[model samples]
Target chain A: MIEHIFPVHPAAIFILGALVIPLLKGRLKQIYLVTLPVVAFVNLLYLPHSVFWVHHIGGFELIFGRVDSMSLPFGYIFIIMAFLGALYAIHLKGSGEHVAAFILVGASLGAVFAGDYISLYLFLAMMTFSSAPLIFYRRRKSATGAGFRYIMFHLFGGSLLLAGIVLHYTFTGHTHFGPLESGGLYFYLVMIGFLVKAAVPPFHAWLSDAYPEGTATGSVFLSAFTTKVGVYVLIRAFAGADILIWLGAIMAVYGVVYAVIENDGRRLLAYHIISQVGYMVAGVGMGTQMAINGAIAHAFCHILYKALLFMGPGAVLYVTGKEKLTELGGLYKTMPITLILFMVGGLSISAVPLFNGFVSKSMIVAAAGLQGEAAVYILLVLASVGTFLHTCLKLPYYTFFARDAGIEAQEPPRNMLMSMGITAFLCLFIGIYPAILYNILPYPVDFVPYTIEKVVEKIALLSFTFLGFWLLKDKIAGQPTISLDTDWFYRKAGTAFMWFCRNPALAFAGWVDMTFARLAGGFLWFCRNPASALATGVDSMFAFVVRIFVGRQRHSPLRALKSVVGWMDRLSLAAEEAAKRRAQREKMAALAQGEVDVRGIDSALFLVALMLALFLLYLAVKYLW
Target chain B: MRYLNNSEKKRIVRYRKHLFYLGLLLLALLEIFIPRDPYFWFDGLPVFYSVFGLLGCILTIIICKTLGRYWLMKSEDYYEE
Candidate 1:
């Protein structure tokens, strides 16, 4: 290869492409589209392994604009992914989204090449805002919901990261992306923000929700770039942070759980993307040289294979317009190449002996083992089995080779097939000869992936898994069920509970006002009393003091106080007098409460009264302050 | 395809099952005799007493199958509402 300094000029070229794309509109858009990515890819291939560049924008020095071995692979993959994604989306018809996708990919690719903290931070934000429209690429009601949720969560992740960036910038004064001498709160806020993109457990709902619903071609763009870019950032910025080990472990297990429960074929694959990255994140957290190598290697493999998985299903969606697992089966009959490509993807992901996932994933697992993380090892292995369940066995069998569910999809378009074929071929290529990937690893490769002992271990495991699938294949009557994930807070319980507490109180007030309109009007006539109004909740301490000092009263104070006191006394005493009336009110409130026991007024009153007093006191303080 | 009596068919099934056990037995023998030096290139050679890898893999697959049966399925209209 020809040597040039900073050979991969990702930004200047791609930005020009993005700017011109919008202008090209409906014209010879294909020319600009093809030229931009091809040139970018060629430029990327020319760069030496790792070179740094610095540019000044106003006052910011932008310390790091370098590319190293670790980044070389990341940038190269994005370039390749962009090329493939562009080709796949060539027929997207509308020109705007195509431009947006290019900007999104280009910005993210540039962001990953960022050497210093400031450049990375700036481009990270750019990458986020750029990709928002892609979430709604299909533009349907479902897409709207999925896309809106996607934007909201990314916004949330962004806020956390911004907080970290602000804190770091404020304290350090030097925006450098390297080992932190001391990182307190800033590190954590930024980490959680990054983790959202990384799709760590509990924060991952936006991914499956947004991705599976994107346009047929939109998903191709979605898979190839950003999230793995997040993992790359995490490795660069916070390697060996200690907590990442457990965080990755949890992500690994959590990903497998959701993947297994998912019935939507595309959603299952989405879940696995996070799970596989979890292995890489955990490896980075291990902090050894070998571990870092493992993480980088795995991330590279993941981007390729994951794209394969998504493309396979997106191709299915392109042909038949269906994605639900139970609604599909035995598609191999019509789409033989698609089936085989999917199978190859599945095998690589399952980390079968001598496949793509086998090499990289085993590296992470072994690194965890050597690091003496017994629990992490066990969970990683369990996650491996789960990967086999959802991806390797479940995905292929259900989609391409199961009991005929009667949907015969034609082969996908040539470009789609070409893209899928390239990714699948890459999967096998990397698997059989991982040394090819290993040599480019930023770190020294002192690790081997395949041996008879290791091979036997992997085989025994896969065989046992084969037996598991054979045994459980009968009970495969699955449906598109929502598993209880961290999203329950926002989706079902949190949102519903807020409404549950709100609507009834509103309606009951409405009903009382409507039913007793005339009588209520009379009460206003008698007592729109200042004390009654002020003490409608709590008389402010300040107001009470002012009333004492000023001695100016707005209402018939004596009458109002006596009437309100009398009503309160009446309200408390009336409960004892009429059993049925008390029971009825309790029942009404119970409907709002979901289940507040009707029979337990005597005991419930003790805690209820105490809590009421505490709440009233809180209101008193709130008003006083 | 060979046509056999019912008893003969049963014997063949038994024989196939027995062969599986025989394969396992040979694998165990090979594990001991095999010095885990590079049967291929040198890196990532299996460190012996990696019994953890072997046993853990078996345990996990069984767990996945069980969970797959128990917890993995739901109705098609699950979140539609």
Candidate 2:
């Protein structure tokens, strides 16, 4: 009986589970949502390390299960985080959020395990669409617009990815997915698309803009999946691409710099997601065996800690209905547990000793040094300093320890705290004994991060960074303001486009319609109703000829008079024919309006003949053209 | 706010600062015995991480502050409004 149990794709469990959510209610829904991810995790363990559940579609293979070193770690963390996220969200009554989030989880896992470009593209596209409602479910006015922009960015990125996929299939005539060379326009297009999802720079604004607007639980789920999926794809496809090294280095620094001035606690953390992912990206870019392994390990650690960080602020928002650092203070006394848990997240992210970040981040930094990329090494180090300055010192100091804001708030619900506790424990565990994480890396375990010298160096750097914060305390204080970013371009441009569509474009279209109508009217008068026109034209010509020839000579005037009469006779025949056509049109309009008798035999036959003539003309033109 | 007396809370805050300062002093003192073998020669200098960490933090503040004053900072409703 056990031998006959077919291998199920891990993602299918959640996807099928998500479909049934709308039917369940209350505790039933909660149990179902929580069980879905657990079942998927179990299914993942049961599946062996080989492609399974392959199907033939057209000429391509659709691989639903491809378990390997690269995909397994991502699968493990994704499922684990989903379970924690579901627990955190267990108190919520909205079934829609659970459904959307579960499908998003399933789709992400599907993308991770997909063995072919077709399946990967399908899952990635699913990931894009299913995750959007997690933002929109907030149902706030700002959420509506932010959600729109978020999807717009993703759709645009999705289009680039789709274009690349189609082009790749056309150029290579292959559908299998694996490491791709950094060659040609299609590959780069695909990379850019991935970069956009990774929230790499100018493409990064959507993360900061939309993430903070999600429902508290939704934000935690979000912080775990989408960007990391992009990183996963990059690791699979574009390892060792030289451009990403520079890009990742820049991203590492860029995120921290922006984070320093950021005041919204959740949004501040959103920027740090970018900063932390920068390490993973830099690691993937370095492309050494240890570096790739480090990249995957860092991604694993980052998912746990970053979700914890987001959940902390999420808890604060849940309790106080406030997310701005400027509006929160002295939260430690009342929400002490939340504060401590949040600090674990903060410390882990800052790469303080005995945290997951310390173990994972050092591998990449060490790789950078070993690879002899001096500039990148320095910038990454600088970014680390900045990460501590913003996330660890500035954010915590202002939110928890600064002057009391006198707002009454307390700890969130039990499930929320438990969710955070799980993540926090993992962060500490991974830090203290990294072999658990290291053993799962794509490469064999070799790195050690806990040497005396390394620990001292970390402590010295962090200690001095804290000293710097103390020295510049006033200057780095949180304020009730926003820091503008690249998103300003689209926000303003969308408004301008709306304005153009409403006013100037409408007016121009109206003008063009009126001009076209007038031109048509003149042509109708000249061609169809020409009898009056011809008579008027003859009179005007006679008067003009008399004015010129009458004064010049008697013979010329007499000849002009005779010529006018002669031309009028020829025109009279044509005018008569035009008048007949005009009368026919009038009769047709009367019959259509029910004013004339279509019951008369002669009138009916005439109409039939005219229709036949017009049909023939149409056929002739069609064939000739 | 709920669990501690006012004086005790004040003491806790003061002690937190004192502990931070003591930790910094320990880091400074420990640098004397730390190994000099570093991947980069520049980072091999005594107290290199500390100096860089301090300078990097200060530089981040100054640069971000300047950016805020002149360009980046705006009313909280900058996007919404």
Candidate 3:
């Protein structure tokens, strides 16, 4: 009887519930949407720490829910964010957005709990397919273009990941999720795949390009899942790989450098997500228990705070339809709650004391210091300062407190404010009481974040950073401009490739085909005119015979034979030409008869009769054979 | 302009000055009292974080601005052309 209660996977709630979402109407739809994540959140708590819902196909075991310390924190934050994301998007009028967000959240949860590479790859692809619609659903030209690019990038990354899994399975003769041994193409392929999603430098431009193009609430949903899942997989597979430490350090600073020049409010925040994920990637690279814990903790905190940050500007965009930082200003006067909430998010991301980022980000920075990597430590610190400069100071200053653009707009809907409030409260709660989050970490909580020296040091760093911003505010004011990133290659190259295919490439292909066709046509003409060649050969042979027999007689019989052969050849050639012309005329007549206009049950009946006759013929052939 | 009174507008105008003085005072207090446990010798210096934060932001802004101006920044429809 106890076993009759099937194990409830958290992902099942969202994955299955998404289908029913379209059936719901109006307020019921909203209620159902909010409840799905709540159910998933509740289910995640009771999920056993061992793999459950195991099914075997052939010799392979498919483990759907692998709940342990490592996955739980990611899963916990994912479902929480899903609930908050749903609430934020509750005012959206369309069901398509809600459906995509559900599938995205569900697929991400499935990925984290996926105990095998097959399940992981499945969920990863699902995540990609579902998330693209969130971007494309906006239906704007830029959004649609960005959505295609986003999916294409992920498809490339997914192919690499799938290739890696196949190689790993072939080499190891099993498909299980665990720490991978270093040595082969599979390892590097898988690592690069994760890095693409993790938004490591050079491959990092997709997040900034696509995230801002999503619908305001859609970006909130998007910010939580895709990159963090990449980080989660990194922790699971490539911990202590050594290369991530450098790649992550580069990603940390690279994202901030881009964010500094960005004029789009959400795009700047998107870049900061790259910067923040870099901390997680670096922590995973450290491969120590404390560092891994730090990565996980930071992933959790970054999701909530990042979503809150997106929500702030999302609310603004929802009301005023402005996304460029240069176009928005003095919104704080009307939207004070959004200002305070956004500040909370900004502070959290900047790692201020009494915010979540401090509690988590400190662990990675401290781990670097303890690991004695001075260069990485310094770079991470610099990135922190940059984070404060752009996200905490520049973005809010320009969008909320800069000289008024004189466009007055009200605060966003209540659900958005409520979601922000919940996220803000969580950020504070985690910062003030780090133990709540620390206790749930994969490693034991041994680090303290609130030492007087640490607090004072953070204060000094942030305070001075604020001073720098204050001094440089005028000089650093946003312009109506877009900053180029690595996506420039694909965006330009993709366009160039399309042009090549349309014009030059097509023309070249046509020329090659025409040349080949001409060469083939010469051979075909010789083959078709065989009667002339035969007649010439026969006439020459007859003349030779007559010369041998008649010995130079004036009227040899060979001449008459040659004339007869020539006449027969001409007749055959004329007949053949006439047949060819007739065939061409027949073809034209058939074409002039136009398409067969079959409609209604007659076509269906004909198809059915053809299938029946073919089946009968197949039976006879099979029996006779 | 829509929501702020005259005093509120004046206070908002003075935000930069207040942030400057407050930031300077905090740095001074940290330099005087904070313990030194540097990961490296440079970090051991008093008010290392302040200098790091200030210098890092400036260098990042300058370098990013330069890069953005010469290479990264483009007209909004750059990709379209």
Candidate 4:
């Protein structure tokens, strides 16, 4: 192991840096924000290639830093992305978003380097909570709702992870964060937790649901971290599970199919995140050294190009306040730089020759071929074709090159363009020199990517896809519509749940309230003049009995009984009237003394008696048992 | 400032379709000369990638559009109402 030259956890730099952001302003804040990532990256370079920062508490170890081949690449790219994201958001005046974003970056790094389950769970939870404000930063109604859903989904996933951790610890008595034994409840629970955050379908709706609702600058950061972190943890823990292979393949094509019909520009890109991460997931499932490297490298290249892709639409949204492709057109005339940079990202993601995606994504596809998984190879290739069709062809055609929509727009801010430019440069650089990326992989790299056969195959595939697009260009244009996905179930279910609460649950509560009120009213009336009421009731009973005995005799012996009953009833009536007058006088006196209603005292006393009875029953049961 | 001037833009617009077709032809020609080591059984066929690309693209479009029209696509406020 390399000796420790830098022992400070990189997450510390970011988390502590976040505290200082609210105190700075103007260019100083920008400089400070940009410097924090740079400092963390430099520190990462010197971090010892071993587990450090281990602490034990309550018979459990919590490791804050675990730097090695497996995690180094992720650590490097995260810091780099933090820099790009910070630069992209440099012009914003608010400090809350900046702070939240910083904390999110720190939490992601914390997760990447965590060597124990406790720290990992903590960082993951922090990442979820911190990243949510970026969605909420949009401050729109849709964004607020989406943010709530986003947190709910992540918290659920986090709970599963926590439960799995607890169970694993109970089973094995260790909290070491490493590969898990398969075919157990904990294994599936942990895998599902990662899958949910990874945006694998059925668990994927939160991404496309919430991402498009983020602020323009915020979405750029949103694109980089959450799912990629999910991918990272999956890589670290569950590399060779067979189920992930088919799930990844399905997820790859799944995103493409949905993206084909999507109309929102950012939402469409969000779907592609699912698609791109699918490639990494499939690679991890392959369990070959080449496949794992490909997964890592693809993740690295994807973060750059994907962020650039988001930056393109984000820039457009920044300038024009529109995110729907149906609402944008002919922007190339005014935003040529944005268009060109966007296409670079577009081409890279499509895996055109000599772009970052070409260099990395091919590794996974080739790994599948080497493993003789013909079906998976074909599925991945087909998904690539779909990727090119929508991201490269459909999106740009509708947003930039189609008939003019007569919307006024111009280039975005300088910092935004600069960030996009730097990201585009990196994508190209990695595409040209795969060695830099290869050298950082967790394992030795020997595969070549620029072989002539591969080049020809990709070129021909993309070229003819263009032909297909030319043929059906009009049919695939963005519509003023939304395509349903798995979120449809939850969104509709949420609505149904609210309806149940509003109608049935609320009606039951109202009925209970009314019954209690009626009971109390009857009891209060009885309490008001109990003596008079009892006397009057007895008099009526006596009169009825006498009448039943001597029915049709006007002046029979029943007349005396009837007179006695009548006199009692009159006496009781007079007594009731006097009691009412006395109560009225007492109420007036109480009012003069600034007191409230005394009638409520009766109900309070009845409630106390009910509680006493319940307590007595509880004591009887406890003692008898 | 625009990346393409008016004349350049008009010129590209006029010849863009021709250029695309030319690109397709050139790619097909390159496939003939490039020595092939097929990874899959079907990849051994002549111009297999071109056919796959074309057919795959068309099929994906047809399948996704059909799904969208019949089931997936809904009104903008499908959730709200």
DockQ for every model, please. Answer: 0.19, 0.73, 0.68, 0.79
Best by DockQ: 4
Q: Give the 10-residue window scoring lowest on summed lDDT in candidate 2 chain A.
A: A589-598
lDDT of 4 by residue, A294-392 (tens): 999999999999999999999999999998988899999999999999999999999998899999999999999988898998899999999999999
Please identify which of the two predictions, 2 or 3, would achieve the higher DockQ against the true structure: 2
lDDT, residue A241, model 3: 80
On a 0 to 100 scale, what is the lDDT of residue A457 in model 2? 85
Cα deviation of A403, candidate 4, in Å? 0.7
The number of the candidate with the highest lDDT is 4
Which portions of model 1 miss their true places by more than 4 Å?
Answer: A1-8, A22-35, A48-53, A493-625, B1-33, B36-81
DockQ of 2: 0.73
Instruction: Encode model 3's per-residue lDDT on A1-625: one tens digit a residue.
Output: 5545555778888888898888889899888888888877767766778878776654567788888999999989999999999999998777899989999988998999999988899899899989999998878989988998998999999999999999999999988988999989999889888888888887888899999999988999999999999999999999998989998888899889889888999999999999999999999999999899999999999998999999999999999999898899998889899999999999999999999999999999999999998999999999999999998899899888888999879988898998999999999999999999998998797899998888888888888887777777887888788988889899889988877765666556555755686699877876788788678768999999988987764478998788789999999999997686556555644553465464654689688889978986886676546
lDDT of 2 at A79: 97
Report the lDDT tens digits of candidate 2 across residue range A286-393: 999989988899899999999999998899888888888888888888899998999999999988889999999999998998898989999999999988888888
Question: How would you encode candidate 1's per-residue C-alpha lDDT over A311-354 as one tens digit per residue?
Answer: 88888888888888878888988999988888888888989876
Off by over 4 Å in 4: A1-5, A518-625, B1-16
The parts of candidate 3 lying over 4 Å away from their true place are: A1-6, A508-625, B1-23
